[model samples]
Target: MVNPVPILQTIATETWIPAAWEDFLTFADDPTLVGGRFYYDQGEMRIEMSPLGSAHGRDNTIVSTLINLYAAMRSFPMQGFTNTTFRKSGLREFQPDLAFYIGEPGQTITFPARSNAAVNLNEFDPPSLVIEIAASSLEDDRTRKQALYQRAGIREYWVVDVNASQVIAVEPSKATQLRRSQVLPGLEIDWVDSALKRAQTEDDGAVSRWFLGLLTQ
Candidate 1:
């Protein structure tokens, strides 16, 4: 007897074929796709096979830096993970551009000492916050992924619109649009947009100082 190969259909650029959950996992395990993001909702899967563009990378770095700086300034317990996969078997999975375990869970989140291991959702709590930087996939991030994150029970979700230089922060459970973070209270959403725009012209140190000024205010 011979094992059958999983069927993979390329629906669009950066989109994965719809397959069974187990099949999607098997496909995702390809070594070439390492560091690549995979998202599964029910039987549908989307894989980001190409590397992130410069704009996407820049926005990701800027936002992550701002979040870390804010956490440090406020003495808030928060830890950010870059492209960490969170999988719940037979349901949904996501690898957001950035994810954070905030507050008490943020202080204690840990992973085994293996390199490049996906964080099993079955074993760990979902991140308190998940952010997607939208350079190309803005609509999907705001609509499909928004509902998916809510179903996964993430506390807060952010869609960073690179084109508009805006951040859409929301409490997934409440389904409310927000101007401030619920997980990291007093952190204004507008500040993130400003920082992202500033980073386009200013060096990181200058951006940090600007954020620090905001924090002090």
Candidate 2:
């Protein structure tokens, strides 16, 4: 077998490579690709090996922070996972920028004992919400990844367009301009978007306080 690591390392980020599902899985298992994100759609596989830059990282942090804050303030049972892979053999897979199990599922979430391991789709249920921070991978995130999430039975999905500073929330079907969450009742998308915009300049502490106030009101 060819050593896939060096080849994978040389591939540019966000570039798609056509390979058999089994071969893609083999490449995915390589420990050297720890920070990379992977996707397998049909017979094509794409691996994003490039490191996340500051803007991407900032937006990711802001989004996760808002989710965590909302869950905490509302006493909504939720668990957040970052860069965790969700895989279904020979079909589809993704490592969402941020994923969450909400309500009963969130309260009762479980995973394998090993850290940084892929969550086998056959074993565990899909998350209530999956978020994609669309910095450079906007097209893939909106199209291919959105379809993949729907197929995986994800209840809600959000594509945070970093450039546009907008949140595209959707159910299993087509994407829509949502102002509230279907999965998390009473969680308003507009508030989330406002906080996201504020995060560009305001400190997280201030932004969090703003969220808390909204929850209390």
Off by over 4 Å in 2: 1-5, 9-13, 104-115, 174-177
Expressed as tens digits, the lDDT of each residue in 1-217 for candidate 1 is 9865433443443654567888787657777557667899967888876667878888899999998988888777876899878878888889999998888423655542335677878877898899999977898898888888999999999999988888999998888999999888889998999998998899889999999998897
Clashes of 2: 0
RMSD of each: 3.5, 3.0
Clashes per candidate, residues 3 or more apart or on different chains: 0, 0
Q: In angstroms, how far off is 156's CA in candidate 1?
A: 0.5
Clashing pairs in 1: none
Give candidate 2's error at residue 197 in angstroms.
1.2
Quote the lDDT for 130 in model 2.
Answer: 95
In order of appearance, the predictions have TM-scores of 0.88, 0.88
Local accuracy of candidate 2 as per-residue lDDT tens digits, 143-190: 888888888888899999888777889886655546789877888888
lDDT of all predictions: 0.83, 0.81
